[model samples]
Target: MRFLVIFLLIAKIYADDHELHSKHHIYKELSHLDLTKEQQHRVKKILKIYRKELKEYKELEEDIEDKRKDIFLQKSFDLEKINSLNQQLDREAHGIENRFLQKMHFVLTPQQRKKFVHYFDDWEVE
Candidate 1:
């Protein structure tokens, strides 16, 4: 019984780590732009801020999912609660973009901004 419990715990931890890595890989792929050192540093700072927001968003999403599951199991729904949570999630999403843009604007020159836009245009979000 103890061995089984240990194995399950290890598996759960591994799965969590894998999920975190996968998320990081996806974000890296989506944001893969060839940047100079200065550009990279500035973008890294922006991404750092984004990472914190994303972590919170993921927790909120998990909470929302748990609520959804509870509703389904109970054969009841709370539309207002769900909507409120969703609105908060939406605000966080918008805040992520706005904060990133604000940071970028402060860190990048006009020419750099143009280049950054081109890079983003070239990137496929998928």
Candidate 2:
């Protein structure tokens, strides 16, 4: 069950990363919404912070990747360590993503939120 949860979380992260190739991809999506200047500024700020958080997390990701490689390469398999790393990555990734989403949800108007939510069919930010 725990492994399944970890698998799902990893899959979700991969899907999200695939969809969001760049911050500009999000900006392009928002362009269709007709956001006001202030809303645009707030969204941009939110994205900037999100990017910074992701950048900081990258080092941790690399460390985890190295650990994963070691686990696979070593004679002894470390299921426990792999699970721990998965949980940590899941928690941090979700934390960063949720913070960005919460900020975006708060910044947009109800109508804008509706449009944005619908535009990305998977996002249930409401």
Candidate 3:
């Protein structure tokens, strides 16, 4: 019974670690680039900034959702407000994505960029 308990605990730990790695699969793909120490450091900083921006984006999305619900709850529909929110969403999405790509482009070598682009084929903005 003790042996079985320990085995289950170990399996649980492994599963948790696997879930974390899967959530940030970018790190796994970046590992294949074989970055130099300086490149890795720079990339880590870039990712930190990217993550902060993403968090803000997510908050904006949630706020927009709340506003949309409020709009519907009102007796009159606000089509203009709905359109404005959509445009803001589009602008924020494109701006964050383009900036991240540009920063990564500057940090990576041509060969690394080639490989990185392939990994992005399956990548999602969210």
Of 1 and 3, which scores higher on lDDT? 3
Model 2 agreement with the true structure over 6-122: per-residue lDDT tens digits: 334333333454434433444555676777767766776676666567656666778998999999899999899999998888788778768977898899888887777764433
lDDT of 1 by residue, 41-82 (tens): 555556555555655656776787787677667766777777
| Residue ranges of candidate 3 with Cα displaced over 4 Å | 1-29, 121-123
Alpha carbon lDDT of each predicted model: 0.56, 0.66, 0.68
Report the number of the highest-TM-score candidate.
3
Per-residue lDDT of model 3, residues 50-126, tens digit only: 66676677789889989989998999999999999988987886787788789989999999988888866332344
- Give the Å shift of residue 126 in candidate 3: 3.8
Runs with alpha carbons beyond 4 Å of true place in candidate 1: 1-39, 119-126
> What TM-score against the true fold does each predicted structure earn?
0.57, 0.69, 0.73
Q: In angstroms, give how far residue 23 of model 1 lies from its true place.
A: 21
In model 1, which range of ten residues has the least summed lDDT?
Answer: 6-15
Clashes of each: 0, 0, 0
Q: How much does candidate 1 score in TM-score? A: 0.57
Which residues of candidate 2, in runs, are more than 4 Å off?
Answer: 1-27, 119-126
Instruction: Report each candidate's C-alpha RMSD, comma-separated, in the order given.
Output: 10.8, 8.8, 10.1
